[model samples]
Target: MEVTPRLTWNEEKSLQKLLGNVSLRLLYKSSVHGNSFGTMLNKCSCQGSTILMVYLPNNVFGIFVLESYPEMSEHLKKPTTSFLLSFQKNKIMEMTAAFFNSTVDLIDNKLRFNFSQVQYVLLRSNTQNIFIPRLLGEKLGLTYDFKSQYTEYEVFRVEGMKDEPGYINRIAGATPHRDSLLAELRAYRPYADLVSEIRILLLGPVGSGKSSFFNSVKSIFRGHLTRQAIVGSDISTITEKYRIYSIKDEKDGKSLPFMLCDSMGLNEKDGVGLCVDDIPHILKGCMPDRYQFNQKPITPKHPTFITSPSLNHRIHCVAYVFDINSIDNLSFQMLAKVKQVQKEVLKCGVSQVALLTKVNNCNGVLQDNFLQMSESMIYKSQVRDVNMMLGIPKSNILVVENYASEREMDPLQDILILSALKQMTRAADDFLEDLPLETDAIAGMFQLCMRCQLPGSRHLAQTGIADSLFETLLPFMFCLLSLRASN
Candidate 1:
């Protein structure tokens, strides 16, 4: 297979001769042909087993192995848009390279890919071996190797996320103390008259675990696996309407002192996903719960809006959610959009934190075993990346794995999620102190940091983060969050 396609769908006879026994179906054609994925899905009727090939504009090509194509029903049969034939036991299907915003990262027998990173994800699907190239080729085995010699897939190979590997922590397998961390989160209380709960505004591109973050936190307090906030795929925002989700204390059955305010997903394009202008309204708590934002540009003339929002309605903290594995996949447009949104957040003097989700993408700890989160230096490096790219203090970025496809609670996962919650809540507290963002807040923040016994704390000196007292306060805040965890 050459970098550029040597054949097209019109040359089916030649293609079939080359593919041999592997059944081939076209899921996507090029722009000139005007054939789209939606059209392809509607017309796809082949049953049982087949491999779905993705033909991109360039020579970019990829395929997914699907086992069944029974009649489409309400149930989500597959999570991947592309499908392929069943090849193994636990892993019923094989997902090779994916197109769209994010590509599959296949490294050392580890598979990290989010269909959301791609432009779209199909019906829910299951797979055991998601590792690209390696697992994919392992499925095709000798058959693919023999036939691939003549197909465009001969050159198929999985690529890494960055151009040159960035700074990575070498430490492995050691993590913060879990039981203690959970205890701290439970013991944490908001100290204020007007603010009973820390209202954190969750923001991130689609499929970044914004809603999952809420569910993960609530599950800890509920003492069971809970899916209180609706979860969606990478293609759309999981939680559409503006809603508030609060954790319920198990003993009292009353709401916790913290709440997560979820909004529409952030899109790469302007006027898509959540409206940029609406952010100010959301930050102010003017956007009412369940208020659906339309595509048309919003104006003040519209009714059903909060006219006189008080500090009670305003967001105390901002938590930016993102998939660590797909950080490289962030589109240039999306990056700019986040920075612009952040500028607005900074102006509000609200404490902000970056939540890196789908942490399984970074290291084997959360990938195959969520318990290994502490020992994974890769997770630490990912946290560092979020700090540099988004201008969040190094300590402000927390890595977490959301509950997905699992029905039971994992202790370590709960600890990571709770640690993040603790940090954000404290950041909110720092903001509520009413210190100016410019000068005195920095000294106040320094004093706050001195109070928290943060481990390996030096985020500010390391990152040289300045200009925002909120950012300066993150290291110390994280110190408190991790204090008991390390103990």
Candidate 2:
């Protein structure tokens, strides 16, 4: 018997986002089909790509079975793409096999779904031992002994899941261009003659995937998943120490020509995340590696502070990492803090870019094929908003999906990461090429003095030092310019 789907509009939208706009046809409902184990097996068996939803009094949770259920299988089958999804108070939490292994078993006259150490049995007559994992159970407020009699279970067959070509242009080639991108990055060198390696700093709000970006990049180069930097979704920042990470080539095991500097995340509340005042010191490259970040900003008096850091120690490019999902909900205080930090970064003349992470979480189509990021309207709109908010050029903003739950490397994902890295290298090169030579220092100082005589030089006039300094450096500036002209 056919049953009408009880899913709300928002719930349907969320499902489409996860499953790529597939149509759901209700196959069986326990309430209408007598809640018998044999009945569900008969109706749902051999249904390709089914979603089994268990509706409890206050919560709804389910398992998405990517493969068809066999009629009679004594042994369990491991499904690769299946996942567990739970909806609590309209918020969804999806967990894949990366979190825990999942298997489907139809034995002992019961249909069973096993997730790691926990099992869910779908039989009303028999006593169901629904032992949910403690971590997940606590999060969803579910007891270990959840009864099947108190819930309604429904199964829906997913359709129209055939692979479709991306509507938009692919951003980067998956396999063909992956090798070339790797080669280009391996052969890269700093444009600045003074610096051997370029230092790119990652900064963002808590849980913005700054550490995850570094981990993803390392995973690509290391040929496996690397978690050197700690990552979590806690309210406070997980990274306490400022770390400067270098990726090594897997073949030779030598450090790459660039370093990624990671620091504490920025929080809206005061005395929480990275201090806005400390940004200047960090940009100046005075902060030492592994320097502990407390609530207070670092000062010149700090014991480990480098009073005169060389160009090699300074940041060449700053990538402002932002989660695509949370960009719209950014707090005013956070934006103000970012703008405040950007002022200091501009003063240092470092290149800035915005990294829109977690693109998969925002669009289901992109989740399946990340190459279509430019084509996804949702993705494009988010990029536009980020560009507007940060005042960064649209070209400077890159989209990436970090490795969260996968065990192996994906070439599609690698392409995105490599493309972003390539842009960073280019941006760093621009900053390096534009850097003032030591011989031009006197000319730069002269330019600063000339600016002091402008109409809005009231502040310099108030200090009463601009005129005297200008008079003192006047002859030297001319001498430097004359020497340059003669050369």
Candidate 3:
């Protein structure tokens, strides 16, 4: 019989590094599954160094071998001849020859150990219990070739995405609703239409799909797929300048009421991304459009800075774009940066949303049925994870399949893009109504700054109770002053 590579390669309960160049087959497991030892023997035409793995309800595990057993039924009736090797951590802990069904005695009397209280290791595992070296494979009457390799393979029958016919059909049915979704979004007038357009600032780590998001939205309204913004696969920021992209209604050719402003991708390198101090300035419309970013911070004194800008020039909403597949790969420092940036967004009193891109690449069912994109388990998990990481609401986080390579317009793709746009506009409207609350936001930032100046908030909160000694000696200074005056 051939060794099952997948079963033997399991590392949960077995040390696979010890299985170097060994013929390992999972012969038998007590009650989990697979053939019995007796049944397996009948199927094997040739045999030598046959190993038996015995597992019981207790934590004890055993390995016994018959050097030369002509028939499988012979051992069932009289099981006393073969030697048993008990091992763990790739070391021979004990070796004993079985006398009968219930007992075993150590082969070496010098080393004494107790098997009397030991019971079976009833854990379920896929790892093999027997290992026969390749040199011994031929000597054991096994004629199978040990060396065979192939570079190309096929997985035509492999297990994969569950087929949900009902859900899939619903997605197909929703294909025609793209126009309606787009119409509803276009009807939405921004709460604070600054300069007749609601400006949304795009923010995310490099490769987090910030640029691609602008391109996807532009493509949707363009009535054909378009790549207005540069998108790349590299980890560095492809967007060098801060630019604003406006969309027009496809049917009426009227300018859309909203615009997406993209910035240099957020970078982890020191002094690479948008500066912390520049955030407040940008929200207030101090930075002008199409200005290339540099490490140095710009103030209102800069040549391109828009001084004393009105509400039309300011950002009304913020969208944090993240790649669904790359959330786990992001470093901790990047997460801290994201939180810091969110604090700035909260202080600006602007509504925020999260866009998770590359949904098709994450799940096959969604790739096959575009309408079933939201129903995918992977998409739902990514949404939940992004929510937990940045504290975005579950409903506000949108899953979108970007127009990366598709040359033509896809209704399903447009539907998702329009849905996200609608939410952004709605959130922007809510922000305009509460714009006066910006003072409270500023106060919160000041409070945080004060706390950070302290040695530590955690220590300060608990320090009062721990300072009884200082409180006890407080009268000594006043008594010393009184004595000096008398002198």
Find the candidate with the highest lDDT and give its number.
2
Order the numbered candidates by TM-score, best leading: 2, 3, 1
* Candidate with maximal TM-score: 2
Off by over 4 Å in 2: 1-173, 361-373, 439-487
**Against the correct fold, how does model 3 do in TM-score?**
0.53
TM, every model: 0.51, 0.57, 0.53
How would you encode candidate 1's per-residue C-alpha lDDT over 62-151 as one tens digit per residue? 343222332334222344333222222211122222222223332332223334543222221121112233333443332332111111
- lDDT, candidates in the order shown: 0.57, 0.71, 0.56
Tens digit of per-residue lDDT, candidate 2, span 77-145: 755245566765554433332223456666565666666554443443354424345555643445564
CA deviation > 4 Å runs, candidate 3 = 1-164, 167-172, 192-195, 361-376, 437-487
Q: Which ten residues in a row have the lowest lDDT in candidate 3?
A: 150-159
Model 2 scores a C-alpha lDDT of 0.71
Candidate 2 total steric clashes: 0
- Candidate 1 error regions (>4 Å): 1-179, 297-300, 361-376, 435-487
Pairs of residues clashing in candidate 3: 56-120, 58-120
In model 2, what are the clashing residue pairs, if there are any?
none
Root-mean-square deviation of each candidate, in angstroms? 20.1, 16.3, 24.8
> After best superposition, candidate 2 residue 316: deviation in angstroms?
0.5
Q: Give the worst 10-residue stretch by lDDT in candidate 1.
A: 166-175
